[model samples]
Target: MKTQTLNVGLVGYGMAGRTFHAPLIQAAPGLELTTVVSRDAERVRADLPDVEVLSRAPALFARPDIDLVVIATPNDTHFPLAKAALGAGKHVVVDKPFSITLSEARLLKSLADEGERLLSVFHNRRWDSDFLTLEALLQAGTLGRVVALESRFDRFRPEVTDRWREHHRPGGGIWYDLGPHLLDQARALFGMPKAILLELATSREGAEVDDDFLALLEYEGLRVTLQASSLVAAPTPRFAVHGTRGSYVKYGLDPQEAWLKAGRTPAPGWGEDPLPGCLTLRDGGEPELVSREHAGLPGDYPVYYAGIAEALLHGTPPPVSVDEALEVMTLLEAGLDSYRQGRWMKLKESNGLRKRLHAH
Candidate 1:
């Protein structure tokens, strides 16, 4: 008998599906780009001539050959599509913020558990060069005890486009769109915060929902700030981590997203970021601080799909596990409560969503 490759059925061939999921899924060793559900069959065929393109997600879920269903649809559509896919007995991968609500994420996790199917979220930012390098530095104590960390995902899209994300829908806006990436990275580094404070703004003219946001994750003796905006024209550091011994600041975002956007496939030296972060050390008691460039680790986005394939094929762990994604979802929803109430939402042991999930 021939070796079996996991057949992936991707829903929504828009930006997430076309740029990230489809290509990364194709690059994985034990995964096959078998089918895609999209309204524009011509567009999908132009990019993937050999793959099958269907007009509806229900059709993709109903197909017997599909082993994994990757949901790259809008945030509001994620829950329904994923639920149906799982009901059809296909393993699922949801593009983040997991879903529009924490309750939905928990329900999905329960369904996956009952069905014995793999359920993962796409937190690709965890593998960015900046994030990877920072993770290494923290593990090696290069920054000593981190006191403050700031993660930003800013862009210069001043004019709001006619897109689903920019609309006034339930999951539309920069907070829901970009917040997941920053929050996931922070949670992955520092775990859940004790409390969360959020400030949202409609910075752009004629914009319906918030286009800029700032969130503060509070921990004991440490503060993690996550920000994203559509009006940031000036240059900003992708990461600025301050610790007892030193500070590591890196300007410019990772180049991996641009590489993928430019239609570059993963290969040798694909994710090696050219810009090195500057680390200022205060190891000495003297007045002067020492500063030097710190090289970043190459990003490995392909590893996500590779890990997913391993989990499905060999019973290894998925790249972005359901529990981890649920944690981010809890924060995402809590941040909204903070923004609405104009107060920090404490996340104690009694907090229903996170606490109960952790207990489980």
Candidate 2:
């Protein structure tokens, strides 16, 4: 008998779905792009004419054909949607920042456990070309010991849009929006930081939310600076890592976002690095900047969905496990606390609940 394919149900048709999840879902094999729940049925149908577009999530959840549900809704609705999907015995994929708080993340984990459903998050930035290159460099130890690492995600949106992001509300700021990506990438490279120093502000006039954030992470001898701003005109170094032996500097954003926004999915040279990174070294007395092409990795966002399918079908672990997401939430809460209290927050003791999850 032929094995059954995983049927997917996407809960939103906004930028997250239109740009990231939908195209990737259709690209991956062993998965069926089944249904999408959107209020504007005409818009959703226009994009995915072949797929079934529903008006509400209940319609999608009620269908036995859907084996997995991907939640790409607002930051506030993540928990409720994930919980309801898991409760209905459907594996789920949540977008980044998982939920508004660490408690909600834990609650969803419990619900998934009780319902025996697989839960994962779409931390797709992990597969960026430059990040993959940096990961390889660090693992190879060509830089000896990494001393300081800097990662920045900046834009020149000085004027705040009418979107919910510019409004001062829960999970409506640069820290919550872009913080997860930076923090998760850091956790992937350098475990959790011992502590973090945050510099957060709202630069855009009449903006009710924070549009700028800079976090300094401290590890015994290694220090990492993560910065994101919405009002920068000049682009700074995308990535800069300094070590005892050499330094690597990469300038340019990954091409995945651009390609995805253009309705292009993962194909040959999909997430290729556009700009050649520079490698500088001081051997004897002089320093040299060596131009090198980073071997780009495929941006496999569909892998997260595929992993969820496999986990539910065979009782395996999801790609972005609940524990890993909790770690990120823990870091986020700590960063916010540090920002609010104006003092360094030790990540180790900040979220006891999250630490327990980490222990497992």
Candidate 1 segments exceeding 4 Å error:
1-3, 283-287, 350-360
Error of 2 at 233 (Å): 1.5
Residue range 1-360, candidate 2, lDDT tens digits? 035578889999888888988988787666788889988889888888898888888878888778889999889989888888888888888999899999999999999888867788888888777888887777777676788899999999977789877787788999999999999998888777788888899898889988999999887677799999998889688899898877888887887788788777677666666686777766554665454545445444556666665666666777788888988998999898999999999876422111221211
TM-score of each: 0.95, 0.92
Q: Model 2 segments beyond 4 Å from truth? A: 283-302, 313-316, 349-360
What alpha-carbon RMSD in Å does predicted model 1 have with respect to the real structure? 3.9
Q: Could you give candidate 1's per-residue lDDT for residues 274-347 as a string of tens digits? A: 99999898646676898999887998999999999898888889989999999899899999999999999997
- Pairs in clash, predicted candidate 2: none
Give model 1's TM-score versus the native structure. 0.95
Q: Distance from true position, residue 115, model 1, in Å?
A: 0.4
- Could you tell me the lDDT of residue 133 within candidate 1? 95
Query: Distance from true position, residue 45, model 1, in Å?
Result: 0.6
